[model samples]
Target: MSGSSSTAANLVRTVKVKAEKKVYSLPGQKYAVPEEREPLRIFYESLSKQKPESEMAEFWLMEHGMMSPERAKKAYEKKQKRQKHQRMGTPIKAEISKETSESSRKSSNAKNDQRTKKRSLEYEDSDDDDLIMKPSKAKQK
Candidate 1:
């Protein structure tokens, strides 16, 4: 029983040492890219050439040490702006004056009020005309 307990104690100590070592080593660990691999280099180079404007190309350049992280980040932001502009189509050059904007808002509010009044009148007329009769409980009995 004593021998078993001693072995268990040794196992626990080894596990704790391993856990501490892992925690300490994680922050300082740097990832080493396999630069010696010709196929991977060629693949990334081809991808970068094919889609120069794409995020994947930027990532490939950054990962392969061809572009710095800061440059990649700027390129990514520019790409995003370009795509957003493309999606939004042409920008309107005409600016509305404050007076015109306020007038338009007032006119729109008036139109909405008129529309609601018309809708309520139509609903009232409809309710009076379409009377759905329900059978009385006395008739059922």
Candidate 2:
């Protein structure tokens, strides 16, 4: 029992050490040397630092790495244009053609008539007793 416990302790220690030393790398690259890893680390740091607060900021950041005055102006104009469209009230009734409106109304009326006919037919075929469900004998037992 003592020998077994010692063997387990040694195994646990070995596993812990190995786990601590484990390295992650891309499939083709077994291990990244300092030179290869440096550029990736710098790129990741830049990405982390350059997180934009909004769509406009994102555009500016992407174009110039940091916001430049010209890019900022363009981004601002784009944002304003989008906001203007959103703020515009619903489309005028005149913009929708009379033909489309009439066709839509006719289609909706036909659908409602079909639904009423189906419901009347269903009621005529079904009895009051059929509508009432009784408990199963197997379930009661």
Candidate 3:
């Protein structure tokens, strides 16, 4: 019963407030809130079409409450870096890994070849005429 009476009182106050305003307003605020802005992709798209980045960044900052001008500046700097990379071209991870793997494989093969050559040379040196060996125990006996 008390809940219903409180609800009635609240409804009456809202009705009185609505009478002064031409259109229905939000419960707390005066007007309907605007929707959220699009992502940075849209800003980048606009940028490609000759839109000013700072203006777009300001608009983004307005929409994002936690964002600051400093952060926006940093974001623009990163975008510039990305554009530079795009212009210079970037290698894919797979291509980099493949190149590294091929070079390492070549180096290992070269080292193995060198080791085999050294071993063969050592064997050839062992067969030299001046080579001498200690007598076996049976020979000494």
Candidate 4:
């Protein structure tokens, strides 16, 4: 019953306020509410074109030897310093493994053979310009 009475009182107050506004002139002009700015189309477009930040960070790590940028820079600086020292001592020659040495020798021999064949062709040409002008063999009827 109390809730119903309170609701009735609220309704009467609302009606009174509406009637008062209709009878009396309200003070100040009602300004138009400003329109909201449109969503940023260009920002979305730019974001779509870009690689993901995490992927870019991973690429950056791989580029700098898979280390943190700071650590990579420190390592690079240390290497540069060591190189600048120009320490001279008995040079450590690289040891060629037997398998690698044999493969390399085979490749070298193949290259030499190619060169020899090329030279032989050149020599034949030098010996006679007509060497390459041999008549085609044909069975005479």
Candidate 5:
């Protein structure tokens, strides 16, 4: 009996939307802000170099109270990747092959199959290159 679409349309809208920036403050107003990625990355690399095969990077973030355990674990993965780049002395980039396109792959596969068929055809009891040979099938007698 109340708030019909027609009646609602007739009345002026009073819905208020909040556009203010939201802030997250801990119980003691402690803000969990992470340090710059570069410095953290450098520190992580140094720490990793000092003690290889240890999960110190995640604990480092936890010790600093910069992020939660879950988030720290994710950041640790990033730390490991960066450390790998540093240890390698060169950043390995993925190489993109031009002939890997969908149409090219299909056309290349078809061409290879056709060439194999033509080669098989030449061995079918004739040295003549002009004759098209059909592949013989085994028929059960």
Candidate 6:
């Protein structure tokens, strides 16, 4: 069915894949694409070579150059700035923590109020019984 008729969407998908493959290929480099390259695993291994926080610095140095300290420092600052901006404009774990704390505090306050109300009712009932008994005792005397 595909030999004679292909949809425009399929054609576009095919073209996009070919373009992506070309973009990923190295210029003037002649080698078959490796059959099994786990890029994510490789990245994790590279990061494992250093501490997690320093991995970004190591990557910038490797990609740019350790020899260029100014460039490295600038890149690091840029990376940090981007990270900070990203964090500034979004919900993070800290927000979740704060929300959880607030909700717990509200629940605890509600529970305490309920306990206080229940205690007040009990005291009122006891006071009413004492008042009634005092009147009866005085009349009997």
TM-scores for all predictions: 0.32, 0.30, 0.24, 0.30, 0.22, 0.24
Tens-place lDDT per residue, model 2, 67-128, is 44555466656656666766895332324588989999999999999999999999888887
Q: Where does the lowest 10-residue lDDT sum fall in candidate 2?
A: 24-33
Q: How many backbone clashes does candidate 2 have?
A: 0
**Candidate 3 clashes between residue pairs 3 or more apart in a chain or in different chains:** none
Provide the lDDT at 116 for model 2: 100
Clashing pairs for model 6 are none
**Model 1 compared with the native: what TM-score?**
0.32
Candidate 1, residue 27: the lDDT equals 21
Look at candidate 5 and give me any clashing residue pairs: none
Provide the lowest-lDDT 10-residue window in model 3: 24-33
Instruction: Count clashes in each candidate, considering only residues at least 3 apart in sequence or on different chains.
Output: 0, 0, 0, 0, 0, 0
Predict model 4's lDDT versus the native: 0.50
Q: Poorest 10 consecutive residues of model 6 by lDDT?
A: 22-31
User: What is candidate 1's local distance difference test score?
Assistant: 0.63
Candidate 3 lDDT, 1-141, residue by residue in tens:
689988888786433444665342211222332334556645544553574445454334333432344654565465556558778897323234778899999999999999999999998878565667767777563
- Pitting candidate 5 against candidate 6, the one with the higher lDDT is 5
Give candidate 6's total backbone clashes. Answer: 0
Q: Model 4, 1-141: lDDT tens per residue? A: 689988888786433344333321212212222223423333333443473333333323323243445654654554444446647543444456999999999999999999999999898779566556868899899
- Estimate, for each residue in 17-112, the C-alpha lDDT of model 5 and write its tens digit: 988754543211123545567687568657766874445654564445455556655655666676799898978554447766777889999999
Better of 2 and 6 by TM-score: 2
Error of 3 at 61 (Å): 30
Model 5 ranges with Cα > 4 A deviation: 1-63, 92-141
Instruction: Record all residue pairs in model 4 with backbone atoms less than 3 Å apart, i.e. clashing.
Output: none
Q: RMSD in Å for candidate 4, one decimal? A: 28.6
